[model samples]
Target: MIDSHIHADTRPFEDFEAMAVSGIREAVTCAHDPLEMLSSDVVMAHFRRILKVDPHRAALNGLKLHTALGVHPRAIPHDYMKVLEELPELLSDPSVVAVGEIGLDSGSETEMNVFIEQLRIADETDRRVIVHTPRSGKEEITPLIADLLSQHIDERRAVIEHVNMDVIPLLIESDFMLGLTVQPEKLTPQEAVQILKEYGTDRFVLNSDMSSSPSDPLSVPRTVHRMRISGFGEGDIMRVSEKNIRKFLKIKN
Candidate 1:
């Protein structure tokens, strides 16, 4: 199973061999900012480790792990565009699966500009687009994103992460896949029902937005149970959880 958004290697370069042993197949790890990771503040304020996770851990394993270097919305700084200009080397990495955690948020103009730059990179590379929309105050930016996405046509596979506000329709109507997270509370059974009825059974998926916090990584399974409680059929759950997710990401890859 894939934790579509994770900080598995935040500081210690903590490999997922333990998570793999625990039964998860793989995860997509992302961090906030390069400066934050390399900053004195992480250790000074949060007492978090500031070590950079080596990408060689991905090479250490074959089927059990892969890494996606997320140029996250929160991470893009003043010189980030220049850094991004030099990212072709990183983008072409064998382990890099997608180009994201890189969309709009409740950030400053600087962050938004960086988001657009990353969007441009994804468009150029024609890879899977992972979106990270904030909980509120992001609707006004959709038109801008749509304009960028419109150029990619049928090849740009879109996946929006940690979606809590109602943007499923936009994703469904457009060419992207909407991934819902089941955390902070477990009673969003309504989300599954809403997606199935409103967006049909093809483009919706569930994800574990795990981080340093203790979370059930089997978030997709919990979502399936909730869907079952909400009157969805077993076939519907199977299709959304197992079949559709792989289908969408495979198309993206």
Candidate 2:
């Protein structure tokens, strides 16, 4: 199964090594670097290292990797315009499946401006996007993002993460894909299964959102297990856990 969204680059190397063996067939490792925290070269180097997948090392774990390259809202530096300017070239890498983990956190004007421009870049590059919605202001920010996205790009090409029950309808109305993050601070696996039960799984995907936090690396597999116990059918499970993400990334298998 594919872990559609995970900050694999932010975790300790040993943790990531262990995670690669934990039943995740593949992972979309979103960039967690706020450009200011690391030079563009340094960040790209990290992706290179992550994607290297030493044949011998990968033989042990059996995990293939993909990447998303963009500035996270919290990681946005003071000279964010400079960062955005560099993104087009950086995002051109073949291993990058999307332009994201990018969007507003506190609804700062600066973050909004940067988020909108990144959406434009994603469109221009013909890559899908992974957006981060604010934790507290879903009602306000979700539609704001929806409006901005409608102006610049196709909502179907974007997957907005961190969605909860309240924001689900708003994003659905806007025609954006929904992501449920399973972790300690965010929603749990059981809650996600219940949401899937209510809404169905056609436009939904599950993620661990496991970054530097104390979140579990096995979150997605555990969620799959929980989903089975909840009586979710295999086809529905495949839709949310695997097929939906592959469709979003435009992957064949």
Which candidate leads in lDDT?
Answer: 2
Please give the lDDT score for candidate 2: 0.79
- By TM-score, the best candidate is 2
Model 2, residue 26: displacement in angstroms?
0.4
Kindly report which residue stretches of model 1 are placed more than 4 angstroms away from their true locations once superposed.
10-23, 31-63, 151-156, 185-190, 213-215, 228-235, 251-253
How would you encode candidate 2's per-residue C-alpha lDDT over 1-253 as one tens digit per residue? 7788887655655555666666677778787652355454555555455455432243346666677878777776666677778789877777778988888788889888888889989999999999888768778888887778788899899998989988887776667888999889788888998898888899899888877676877788888899999998999888888899999998766
Candidate 2, 209: how far from true, in Å? 0.8
Error of 2 at 128 (Å): 0.3
| Over 4 Å off, model 2 | 13-21, 33-60
Q: TM-score for model 2? A: 0.89
